[model samples]
Target: MEITIISAQGLKKLSFFTHNLQPFIQLTTTPPGAHRSHVYTTTVDHEGGVNPTWGDKFDLSNIIDPSEFFYNKCSCIYLYLYTNRVLLGPRLLGWCGIPVADFVDGMASVGTVRWLSYRLRKKDGSKGHGVVNVMVKLDSSVFRKKGGSDVRWLPEVNVGRVAIGIPVRTLPVVNYIIYYKTIK
Candidate 1:
């Protein structure tokens, strides 16, 4: 899996001395059953202040177990927004956890780049002032042909019935129904 840290918006200034925020993002993820988490950091954006853009891409293959990450309900990619301080150390401004399930839909839309934004949260889990934008892509290798054949296997899908209703003055009512079959 690969993720691009595009930017953040509406970030609150956490420092008392300066309103100018030199913010950067740190991403961490721990695979199911793994003892340690993998961490990646982005370069600080000095000029962006309340809105910062990094556009940094990181490969998370090292920490991701496709089967576990995509299936485990507890799997999440944690994002922490921080302001770099010369002497006081990095201070956490806000953070959020993005569940791996958020990327599952993109897997079915193979070769498509999807950008998602999540609201940042305070230390106490309250909604914070910033939103983080990121682009996620599943590696192509994940969809390689099985059994050395040209045919590629797709993930199984289960869908329910959807009904559309149309109201007509003359006919009273008309219904259009579409049913999606479960793909295995």
Candidate 2:
């Protein structure tokens, strides 16, 4: 629950034209299958980036208010960045860590992932190795799958079985399907 790295801009402050953004390690708390209109609150743009599109006007509400938006937690952020490069942290920044004129040229650098083995049958039965809850690690430059094909959400991370849109329900979204996985 210590993810920080916001303040990346260059291609004219990027209004729209992203490549990667699977950065999760959430837990400001909530996180399960989120979507009860996904309440819980950390202000994540009204718990979920209230109505946005195109140049998706950034507004995650001043970095999660009061801290407590853990609706369906289980993401752990680790795609760093790829699509030309941006691996960040643990190596003084990898893939060159942002500097291709700020991205938006050809874009190509996938890092693929998958290591889920979750297990936590708790209601009282209590059994675990680790699953304190709240992780939320999504992929594909911030979920996108309406018109699909922004290169078709490139992320064969490691292929599990079936996963898309954080265990979604309804569809016809504006853009949403950057798959990430985890749930205890």
Clash totals, every prediction:
0, 20
What lDDT tens digits, residue by residue, belong to model 1 across residues 1-184?
7899999999888757776899998888843234545679999999999999999999987777665566555678988889988788898888888876577653665566779999999878888899999998877654554234353534443333346898546855779999999999
lDDT of 2 by residue, 35-88 (tens): 322122121211111121111122232333211222212222221111122443
Best by TM-score: 1
lDDT per prediction?
0.78, 0.25
**Model 1 whole-model lDDT (C-alpha atoms):** 0.78
Q: What stretches of model 1 exceed 4 Å from their correct place?
A: 30-36, 144-184
Global lDDT of model 2:
0.25
Q: What TM-score does model 1 achieve against the real structure?
A: 0.73
TM-score of each: 0.73, 0.17
RMSD of each: 8.9, 23.5
RMSD of 1: 8.9
Worst 10 residues of 2 by lDDT: 91-100
